[model samples]
Target: MSREKTKGMSIIVKTITRLTVGLVLLYGIYIVLHGHVSPGGGFAGGVIITLSFVHLVLAYGKDTALKKLSKARASFLENMGAILFLSIALLGFMGGYFFSNFIPKGEPFHLFSAGIIPISNIAISLKVGAGLFSIFVALVLLKLKPTSEKKK
Candidate 1:
């Protein structure tokens, strides 16, 4: 296959994506981490994170995006996130309730102030981000499959 056929998009789009994709991923992480103190939380941050990968897929094609994060890895991360969140909630039983705030609440407006909340947010972001990305990948794969195979 020719270079243009294998690689996706124009050089300009690829260059711009290379420059901005990391920033977009970082912004998503920032949102997830600061969810307790800011307006954006796990769900919004997850969407942003998924967008970063989607951007890559659009700019560099499915092959490149899959190389960065394969279907198996995405599924693994999604499962891990759910497990972590569940473990956190289950641990709250030690505090006499489900999903209780067992960790010490530090000073307000600080990074570590919310304790378990931040941790929970991280777990949620992982689950949401990976799950959404997995869904996107599945849809892409489905669309790309041969119609005869799909019918079988």
Candidate 2:
């Protein structure tokens, strides 16, 4: 197949992906935010977020997906997530414990009721999502390298 033809999947698949990708991303965010109150958490939410990108790549090709989230940006986000998470943990020192809950815990079963848990979840989600996406991009590049070399 020509490079253009090989870039993405069929139009039907692309259409479906376009329709659903945003919902997938939204759901991931929901998972991350509600993790402290529910079953899902940072890791699960991050995987969901990564899958949204993966779906985009599968349906619309790497060029489109990379335009949205470049590898460099992904690395930056990963680093920022790590720094944020570490900072949150370090701040707990003021509470006289590592990873202690320093912020006020509001009423139960409500948003913002978990002190720093939601913030930590956001940090973990950023780290895992970007890291996983970067790994996927690297693997995709690695697979393409040998194929292009063979053609050359």
Candidate 3:
């Protein structure tokens, strides 16, 4: 008989995960968006975002977490994040120095204010979040390899 793929943890754990994961993701996005105005920035927010996925992995399993976010997709996102951050930095050349604030800063406290801060925060968040996830996946995959197979 063919063994079916494992889905996740028990019902209670899954139910809680389903309820809380969205909130965690939302908070991460909020932190990223408000990085300029508030304390939390891309790195912190990205870590939180990564934690949400890691929570899934811990609660459910690698298979379930990976099913939601495949390795290939995570790699692609990580690359995209780096490229985007680099592009933003490069764009600063048009303004003046590296990562210069090119756009006009609106009235303080508004969403569009702080010029490139929010955008940069977003780019950094993407990079950090995806990078962390990729690393986790790599470690997990490496651990899964059979010890005896290494000798063969």
Best by lDDT: 2
Cα lDDT tens digits for candidate 3, 19-110? 99999999999999999888999999999999999998988888888999999998898899899989999999999989898989899988
Tens-digit lDDT string for candidate 2 (1-152): 67786678887998899899999999999999999999999999999999999999989989999999999999999999999999999999988898999999999999879799999999999999999999999998775335676788
Query: How do the residues 86-134 of candidate 1 rate in per-residue lDDT, one tens digit apiece?
Result: 9999999988899999999999999988769999999999999999999
Candidate lDDT (C-alpha), each: 0.94, 0.95, 0.89
Assess every candidate by TM-score: 0.91, 0.90, 0.87
What's the residue-level lDDT of 96 in candidate 2?
Answer: 86
Give me candidate 2's TM-score against the actual structure. 0.90
| Number of the candidate with higher lDDT, 1 or 3 | 1
Model 1 CA deviation exceeding 4 Å by range: 4-6, 144-152
Against the hidden true structure, what lDDT does model 3 obtain?
0.89
Candidate 3: regions farther than 4 A off: 1-7, 144-152
Indicate the TM-score of model 3. Answer: 0.87
lDDT agreement of model 2 with the native:
0.95
Candidate 1 clashing pairs, residues 3+ apart or interchain = none
Model 3, residue 60: distance off in Å is 2.0
